[model samples]
Target chain A: MTATLTPAPEKAPRRARASSGASRRRDSGPLERQQSRLFWPFVAPALLVYGLLFLAPIAYAAWTSLYRWDGMGEMEWQGLKNYWILWNDPNFASSIVNTLKILVIGGVITFLCSFLLTLVLREMRAKLFARSVLFFPNLVNAMVFGAVAGFLFSPDGPVNAVLGWVGVETPPKWLGTDNVFTLIMATLIWTATGYYTTIIMAAVDQIPPYLYEAAELEGASAWQRLRHVTIPLAWDVITVCAVLWTVSSVKVFELILLFGGSNAAEPPMQTWTTAVYVYASVFPTGSVPKLGLASAAALVSLVMVGLFTVLLRRLMRRDPIRY
Target chain B: MRGPKIVAAGVMAALALAACGGSPSENGSAEGGGKGEFTYWSMWRADEPQAKVIKAAIDRFQAETGTKVKVEWQGRDIKVKIGPAIAAGKAPDLWDNAADVVSTTVVTGQAADLSSVFDSQVPGEGKKVSELIDTKLVDTLPKDPSGSTKWLVPYELISTGWFYNAADKDLAEQPKTWDELIKLCDALKAKDKPCLASDGELMWENFLTLDLLLVRDNGAGTLAKIFEDKSGAGWDAPGVLESAKRMEQLVKGGYLIKGYDASKYPAQQTNWAQGKAAFLSNGSWVAAEVSTLVGPDWKMGALQIPPTKGGNTEVNVSLIGFSVPKKAENPEPAKRFISYFIKKDNLEKIATEAKNITPRADIPAPAELADVQKQLSSNPVRPVLDNLPREYNQKVLFPAFLEMWHGKISAQEFVAKAKEAHVQYWKTAG
Candidate 1:
């Protein structure tokens, strides 16, 4: 190892001393040549794998969307017909609406709760423990929440029992067709707010304590210090968090599926998101699956995520505060 | 840098191994066709009573033939787990599922042709396997619409309709007609109890109510025609609107137990068993599902809602059957097991141990379901709405029917929406 390494350094000096004009003008090191030779070998395997598993499958789904197929049998060319059907489908349209509700409405409520909690938790003892408790739901499988929601909200469940104890005889039906989606959105926000708060708090902690001290010295007040010093420094992270929530919210399925009951055939159409729509289109109980429509719905969801991500980054972009 | 390079190489090796499907998923197959090791995937969970009886049967088969049969209890996730495996051609030698298998396996075609298995006689039955099973189930076994080829060995039949508490001594004898059923439901309502306790979220439970009404008002032929006629005409057949109206009357009259629409399934069943409500619309499986909850001697009875105005006794029946994957390497034993399964004695063991009905005609119905079973048997069997295009019942009829039951739509509106959904489904699924 030493001999080979010595030759590269030694050759560089001798070549520099012996060379005239052209050769001396260009000093190409052996190490640089070695690195160039090894680059593709280092990168090609990961690139090939990513292409096969991710890119190829995505491309195949896109191509498959052009045909009417049942995950089996002959593929009939439907061209734009599947997408046309999706456009006219009230259920699909409603599903997209539900996805947006969870994305935009659920996002707002989750971040609002998170930012409030972060402000208080920063100064509190056992703040780390509270953060862990808040983030615990993410560790459990989401279907557990769905199943628990079913039992908790049942007419004779503990939630109603509490209401009864409070002398409210007629509690609103929490799992009714009208209210189940609202409960789902609420549950998503509660479970998700902790995770983003943890991230935002970490970014806020990275902001210099001196910045807050200076603001306090100038009598900027708590609200103004938060508005100017803390938020600006955390703007870049908040953008990433928005993109993360947008992607995750649209993919919500298990909670909604099990919210009404752990074993209902499917969640009511009133609660469906694009993810649920895609799954039901492909594997609806007792019906012939529509794979082409499933692919189209999936592609639409991908477009939604892509569009939101770009918008989030654009809107949240700022001149970096280097404090 | 060296550490990252090592990690990258490790990941590359892992991906390559995964791409190659490391170590072939070999389920043992017979070498020359005598008896060999094979695998069976059952939908029953390990703790289920059916699992024990099935495992005992497998043990008996293994002891007799020296075959090492691997039994995997997959519960409901059996399909979800083995669906892709079957497509990848790694399905077990013997898997029990049907109908849902059609689009993925029976047609495309991943399932073995079981017509010959049907031809194979049940031991000591003195008839072909087809004759021993309920004729309705045999007829209802889904065939490739493109052509006729039997793909399932019909085994268990669960009769669908309403269940009543035998414990309610004041409960009168079964109604003889649709008007009588309405009278009975309303009479129960007058006494502050509804005639039927239902889980409205389960669309099929409500759809079954419509099916029995349709059958009594229009014979089985109307249903068969309904399947053939994709136009709104099929959904709007002569008696269809009237039956929906009759059902709408019961819904409007508040004859169903209060809060039916909000109740989830099994919760409704459990409530019925608990005697919180008088009657439940469910399948024969209700007895076995809530047997413990109702108490051993508590005794429950089933009654199919009677026909309308001296109408015929046509009733709905569903079949639970077995099928083999085309990729199964040991069809010989799988075929043998299918035959072995139908012997009146082995079936009786399943009935006695699992406490569920088997398809053999010779066996009397289990005590809980005996009344409904007799009603189901008195006439020729017909498929339940489950046999309809799943989209028709699930997407079209279900939502529409549920809305009407919720009193959100009129029976006339349900008919219109069902027709529109039918048109849309035919246009796309075609």
Candidate 2:
């Protein structure tokens, strides 16, 4: 019995070796192993959700654009007629102009304010307190902020009241007239500065303290440090933010809807961005449903957004900087 | 690692559990199945006492039918909720909406055909709907320019006219003619009170008032021709131009409240309610809204805008209504509910709760609505606003009227612009 047990123990090593060899063969190459194990495990679920929720819907919208559908009836194929109509539509042209204005003017204003705010926050002695205070507006929802902002700039609101106290007889209507682009841009700046500042501040903070010291030793002023050291180091983050802001600003609806200040359909038609125009086409004032036209409008807007994203990406190409 | 993975697994399990638990009634059946429960969504807010009344009615209905009912308050913004549901094929079984909305809802096939339901429930079962609602108004619904009855059904009837303070003895009692109304404005102006306080943001209301003036002066057929032909040549008609000229005079005469261009409907209404202005053009619904602005002590009266020749003639009424979806899950139940809800007793209940006028001719007018009914009954009820095509309403008419009101363009210029816009709208819309 002792001899048999000893033989069994000796054979266990051989069996273990054989099993280990087979397992190694199963997991031979890094790429094949990753495909079998890590790739599907890490990526499949997210890809499935994204494809189902977003990509599929976008694909469907693209398909729908080729047809004239009134939402409830049988869809009729219209080929490129809808697109042809959109090309000549004045509202579509105005929407494009308005979107670009928001992107360029609003983008520049937000970027400058955010960068300045970050610098101010970083240089402040009470950094934590200052940063918290600066970042507070980011916590408030945009819709709520829009309401509060509207009240502040209303004809008889506190801003005008303050202007009254200052003995300025005529205060321009912030919400009225056709110059709503200015008001919208100002709102965008006010809303986005804090959030972008936080993002930029993180990028700014990641830079080594020694870089600034080196700049100082090289006889650089504060301005020079920002221009030469800070900005260059934060270029990647700034570009990313710009790209994000461009996409988001094009899709802005709630603020314009709420504070575009009634008589929404007519003049100051220039105030309507693509997103607002699309929304209005879908759900116009009063009670006329134009579902087919609205769907067509949405398709046009998607194309515009896609074209814009590609153009922006091409224009804003920058090497990723290692800090 | 094993412990953390177990915690992550537990979290995922919890999320999965929550998701599974969320869809308890996807099949539209109420829990317990002892009694059938139906859900009703309304534009009324939860805080409104009317919502409570609606809930009470639901409860009463449930008790009578041995089915449970739930009333959900969706607030005044119906578009946000209803639009999506209509798109998704899950719209509410019953809803309250303006008559204009019914036109679009019907055209899009979102509204259920209630012809049979109307026959079974309404008192005048076989009567032509045009006889109940103004036939001319039914003609206004969007069609292929071939005149089709795309939609029909009205729940409430409201008329737009000038409402004035009853206590203000200085204000003339319901100006009978355009000239007399202007004279009244002059008198009010002399008394250091504004003759009219209006919300410019509601460009449509002001335009409707102007349209009514045109109708009264040019005869009712003028606007109908314009809508039918999609031309502004009708706008340049002698009586129509005169009406625009009259509007300009009123604006120049300082009859409107201060900052009229910037003010919204609520603000203008409040201004009138505060007695800052002696008159306001609005619907009968304002009686309730005004009571909230001022106190119950402020007595109110309505008057049809006078005709051009000082005659007690043309009167127009605005109607609001409800429509059922064509693809409703429970069509029979939906029809029964709508029919029950619009019956005389039910109509009175809703009117009392909503503090608005009921459309049913059989029901006696409530005390607050009696004056409006009396004024409107003397003349033919006409749905002026609803009698125009969607494109005319949105593109040509409203924008041009707004420009005219803002003093940016003369009435002639307004007419020219309107004609161009009308042509453009018809090109696509037709």
Candidate 3:
């Protein structure tokens, strides 16, 4: 999400230099001048809308984080004490660790699977149909997955009943606290890999078919072709995908919240991400709402997303490869 | 082509800007109503039995008082909406919720004192609303900031206990002590039946065994005090430690139904109703919730947590009650309606149609809840956990017990971790 901010600075200087070169030539046409004249008028509305709808809420959240308000009473100045509470909170610490696990561990597995799927898929007939089949899960609501998992993995549900039929009397508890996160990560990867694969495959399609033909003619293996051609060609899309995953992984809430169909109360602390932490703090059942504490947690997550987005962009920056 | 595309883009941007500038219309307006009416937001959905009972009462209340009542059937999480509404100075004239939730969400500033409503006589009962309900149950309602003025007038009561199939003659014998309870578990397990069924993901359902153990053994408010202790040393109390040890026994003894620790809400409890298990530790509402699952052959019965030495015998109760917000434009009519609500005719539906316990001791309970109702009558009542702070309950207390329940740690380890969390909480919370 923070990638939206990084591109503007990089593009501004290049645009300025091009316009300066055009001015030096004194060759600007009536069309170019008119377009320039319309630019501000065209863009002003979008900028204003973005400022009000997007940036203003973030600023308001930052301001609210410094006060101790429960949404009902007078706002008492809490300053940074709310953040201090979060820093000391063991639950909050685990929540951050869980968020990072989704970003790093889940990211690696998902990207690797997506790349492999994209490569094999690029060589196949009916690849479009296969890609659509793979992407089907992305269209389903997350609550459906959570509910299906509860049914499939219930103690005496189908999974265990099948194991019992096989004479394996004791199946591991799939939704146990020790195992729930692994299941969640696996589900996330299963649903996400297809999306990344589709995007990378779209970029891969733009590469000349002769590039692969030429590689194969020179005795290049599939792995060598993928390494030398496919990845380099699709690097731009992959970079965007990584940044998308980072932001999304940090914001993973509904799957974990409704995991195991346990929405009657808060989900297990073991499954909480930063998003879940913010939500639980604000709308806790049988407890007072802590808007200030929730705002602090939310700001911390926003900063994490910003830092990670910038880091990913810098690491992935490369000279554009022309076909 | 270029000019048209640019115009289209500009129009889209303008439309987006217009969309951003529009604000949500104020909804469920609580004031500026016709003179004879007031607004109420309820914590029950329109289709729920509780809502039906209340709807009936509203019709009767309107007929008797000639005052109109507008109700919005906000579901269980009504507090989420009520918080912002109260903050915006648009709170409904009256609302109802669990005492602890109402205290934290509305009573802090918005709840009007309802002590006067308590003293006013009911139309046909020839008694004040306060006189109708047990004084013990009345004391459990949330009060104003002054600590002496009452704010909530409760109509329904919920208490937790072990619910079982009364038709199971072999399980008819109730355990009088914790050891006997374990013996019964052993007997059931020998017959290939689990003694208890509990959902692991719902932290409160899992925590109930410990909560009841601590409260029933030491007294009500024991768990609350342990949570309030800033030093985190409260876990060292004999009652607290002993409760943990008892929970450890349930885990080690394998008394919980297979996969109880991994099942979801209504799953394990449904299993209990299906006769896969002999007992379910849950609130009184479980009978109503799983009534469909249990066939005609099955009958529901409840047993209190077995008492211990020096234990308080009083029931630990939670009240779901009505409160008039302080900014209410028609507090008198709302209060008057509440008095009518507790009348014998209206309150009886809570027990009959809703399958819940009514706070009015004069009203008989549903057949399934007679034991729970009898306990409420015979014993004085105290609020559960004395209304423990939500942060501590959810963040610190629940995880500690959860780890123990998952069998990753022993009872001693549970106490140690809980104590550490308590100390860390205060260090930052201070």
Structural similarity to truth (TM-score) of each candidate = 0.86, 0.82, 0.92
- List where candidate 1 sits over 4 angstroms from the true fold: A1-42, A72-80, A124-126, A165-169, A260-264, B1-39, B66-70, B81-83, B98-104, B107-110, B124-126, B145-149, B221-228, B295-297
iRMS, model 1 (angstroms): 9.0
Q: For residues B237-277, write the lDDT of model 1, one tens digit per residue.
A: 76888888988898898887766666555566777777777
Note the residue pairs that clash in candidate 2: B43-B75, B112-B324, B112-B325, B112-B326, B176-B306
Error of 3 at A5 (Å): 24
The candidates, ranked best first by TM-score, are 3, 1, 2
Which one wins on lDDT?
3
Ten-residue stretch with the least lDDT total in model 3 chain B: B1-10
> Ten consecutive residues with minimal summed lDDT in candidate 1 chain A?
A1-10
For residues B1-430, write the lDDT of model 2, one tens digit per residue. 1111222222223333333433223534333322354456675687876566556666666667665555568875675456446555556666766665555566556676666554554433544433444344434344422344534455567777788877678764666567788888888888888988877656556776787777777776577787667554665667777878888887777888876665433666777899988888876777777777775666777767777775536666766665666545455555556555555555676567677666665565666667787766567666656366444565567767777776778878877887887676655652
> What lDDT score goes with residue A128 in model 2?
76
Q: Best by DockQ, which number?
A: 3
CA shift at A293, candidate 2, in angstroms? 3.1
Per-model TM-score (chain A alone) = 0.86, 0.81, 0.90
Name the better of 1 and 2 by DockQ.
1
- Residue range with the least summed lDDT across 10 consecutive positions in model 2 chain B: B1-10
lDDT winner between 1 and 3, please give it: 3
Which pairs clash in model 3? B110-B326
User: Which ten contiguous residues of candidate 3 chain A have the minimum total lDDT?
Assistant: A1-10
Residue lDDT tens for model 3, B52-136: 9999999978887789998999998787777766666567888999887788754457678888988999888799887887777
lDDT of 1 at A38: 95
